[model samples]
Target: MVHRKHNRVDGKGRIVIPVKIRQAMGIEPGSMIEFDYMARRHQLVIRAVTETDQRAHNRET
Candidate 1:
Protein backbone atom coordinates (compact mmCIF):
# COMPACT_ATOMS: atom_id res chain seq x y z
CA MET A 1 0.00 0.00 0.00
CA VAL A 2 1.21 3.47 -0.79
CA HIS A 3 1.17 6.08 1.93
CA ARG A 4 0.42 9.64 0.95
CA LYS A 5 0.15 12.79 3.00
CA HIS A 6 -2.05 15.68 1.93
CA ASN A 7 -3.52 18.78 3.45
CA ARG A 8 -7.14 19.78 3.83
CA VAL A 9 -9.06 22.10 1.57
CA ASP A 10 -9.19 25.85 1.77
CA GLY A 11 -12.25 27.96 2.68
CA LYS A 12 -13.44 27.56 -0.91
CA GLY A 13 -13.53 23.78 -0.43
CA ARG A 14 -10.98 23.11 -3.13
CA ILE A 15 -8.15 20.62 -2.81
CA VAL A 16 -5.26 20.08 -5.20
CA ILE A 17 -4.45 16.65 -6.51
CA PRO A 18 -0.82 15.72 -6.57
CA VAL A 19 0.64 15.27 -10.04
CA LYS A 20 2.15 11.85 -9.33
CA ILE A 21 -1.14 10.38 -8.20
CA ARG A 22 -3.01 11.94 -11.10
CA GLN A 23 -0.73 10.24 -13.59
CA ALA A 24 -0.82 6.92 -11.72
CA MET A 25 -4.60 6.91 -11.69
CA GLY A 26 -4.93 8.18 -15.24
CA ILE A 27 -6.94 11.16 -14.10
CA GLU A 28 -6.97 14.03 -16.55
CA PRO A 29 -8.23 17.57 -16.38
CA GLY A 30 -12.05 17.70 -16.23
CA SER A 31 -12.27 13.95 -15.66
CA MET A 32 -15.21 12.70 -13.64
CA ILE A 33 -14.57 11.61 -10.05
CA GLU A 34 -16.76 10.03 -7.41
CA PHE A 35 -16.51 9.66 -3.66
CA ASP A 36 -18.19 6.95 -1.63
CA TYR A 37 -18.35 6.43 2.11
CA MET A 38 -19.19 3.35 4.11
CA ALA A 39 -20.71 4.74 7.27
CA ARG A 40 -20.56 1.45 9.11
CA ARG A 41 -16.92 0.93 8.33
CA HIS A 42 -15.96 4.56 8.59
CA GLN A 43 -14.17 4.42 5.31
CA LEU A 44 -14.01 6.64 2.26
CA VAL A 45 -12.85 6.00 -1.26
CA ILE A 46 -12.27 8.15 -4.28
CA ARG A 47 -12.94 6.67 -7.69
CA ALA A 48 -12.55 7.82 -11.25
CA VAL A 49 -16.16 7.41 -12.39
CA THR A 50 -19.78 6.86 -11.52
CA GLU A 51 -22.43 4.13 -11.79
CA THR A 52 -23.13 5.07 -15.41
CA ASP A 53 -19.98 3.17 -16.28
CA GLN A 54 -21.55 -0.07 -15.00
CA ARG A 55 -24.67 -0.10 -17.18
CA ALA A 56 -23.56 -3.22 -19.01
CA HIS A 57 -22.82 -5.18 -15.84
CA ASN A 58 -26.32 -4.80 -14.40
CA ARG A 59 -28.49 -7.87 -13.91
CA GLU A 60 -32.09 -8.11 -15.16
CA THR A 61 -34.56 -7.61 -12.36
Candidate 2:
Protein backbone atom coordinates (compact mmCIF):
# COMPACT_ATOMS: atom_id res chain seq x y z
CA MET A 1 0.00 0.00 0.00
CA VAL A 2 1.08 3.56 -0.63
CA HIS A 3 1.39 5.94 2.29
CA ARG A 4 0.83 9.63 1.87
CA LYS A 5 1.41 12.49 4.27
CA HIS A 6 1.18 16.24 4.10
CA ASN A 7 4.11 18.39 5.15
CA ARG A 8 4.74 22.12 5.10
CA VAL A 9 7.95 23.86 4.27
CA ASP A 10 9.55 25.89 7.03
CA GLY A 11 10.93 29.40 6.82
CA LYS A 12 14.22 27.91 5.65
CA GLY A 13 12.46 26.14 2.75
CA ARG A 14 13.09 22.77 4.34
CA ILE A 15 10.36 20.19 4.63
CA VAL A 16 10.71 17.07 6.72
CA ILE A 17 9.90 13.74 5.17
CA PRO A 18 7.92 11.49 7.48
CA VAL A 19 9.90 8.72 9.14
CA LYS A 20 7.56 6.09 7.80
CA ILE A 21 8.04 7.25 4.25
CA ARG A 22 11.77 7.54 4.69
CA GLN A 23 12.10 4.08 6.12
CA ALA A 24 9.93 2.60 3.39
CA MET A 25 12.21 4.12 0.81
CA GLY A 26 15.33 2.98 2.61
CA ILE A 27 16.36 6.58 3.09
CA GLU A 28 18.79 7.01 5.94
CA PRO A 29 20.94 9.87 7.06
CA GLY A 30 23.40 10.91 4.31
CA SER A 31 21.18 9.32 1.67
CA MET A 32 20.79 11.60 -1.32
CA ILE A 33 17.37 12.50 -2.72
CA GLU A 34 16.48 13.91 -6.07
CA PHE A 35 13.55 16.19 -6.75
CA ASP A 36 11.97 16.71 -10.14
CA TYR A 37 9.21 19.09 -11.00
CA MET A 38 6.87 18.09 -13.78
CA ALA A 39 5.65 21.34 -15.18
CA ARG A 40 3.07 19.83 -17.47
CA ARG A 41 1.76 17.49 -14.82
CA HIS A 42 1.92 20.12 -12.11
CA GLN A 43 3.60 17.75 -9.74
CA LEU A 44 6.79 17.29 -7.81
CA VAL A 45 8.55 13.92 -7.80
CA ILE A 46 10.97 12.87 -5.11
CA ARG A 47 13.20 9.83 -5.38
CA ALA A 48 15.99 8.28 -3.41
CA VAL A 49 19.34 8.43 -5.14
CA THR A 50 20.54 4.86 -5.38
CA GLU A 51 23.68 3.29 -6.73
CA THR A 52 21.80 1.95 -9.78
CA ASP A 53 20.59 5.43 -10.57
CA GLN A 54 24.10 6.77 -10.21
CA ARG A 55 25.45 4.15 -12.57
CA ALA A 56 22.83 4.92 -15.19
CA HIS A 57 23.46 8.65 -14.85
CA ASN A 58 27.16 8.15 -15.22
CA ARG A 59 26.69 6.14 -18.37
CA GLU A 60 24.48 8.89 -19.81
CA THR A 61 27.26 11.40 -19.31
Q: Count the backbone clashes (under 3 Å) in each candidate.
A: 0, 0
Quantify all predictions' global Cα lDDT against the true fold. Answer: 0.73, 0.94
For residues 1-61, could you state the per-residue lDDT of candidate 1 as single tens digits?
A: 4748587999998887788777777779877777799999999787776356545335432
Residue 23 C-alpha lDDT in model 2: 96
Question: All candidates' TM-scores?
Answer: 0.66, 0.83
Worst 10 residues of 1 by lDDT: 52-61
Best of the candidates, TM-score: 2
| Segments in model 2 whose C-alpha atoms lie over 4 Å from true places | 58-61
For residues 1-61, write the lDDT of model 2, one tens digit per residue.
6999999999999999999999999999999899999999999999999989989999999
For model 2, what is the error of residue 55's alpha carbon versus the real structure, in angstroms, after optimal superposition? Answer: 3.7
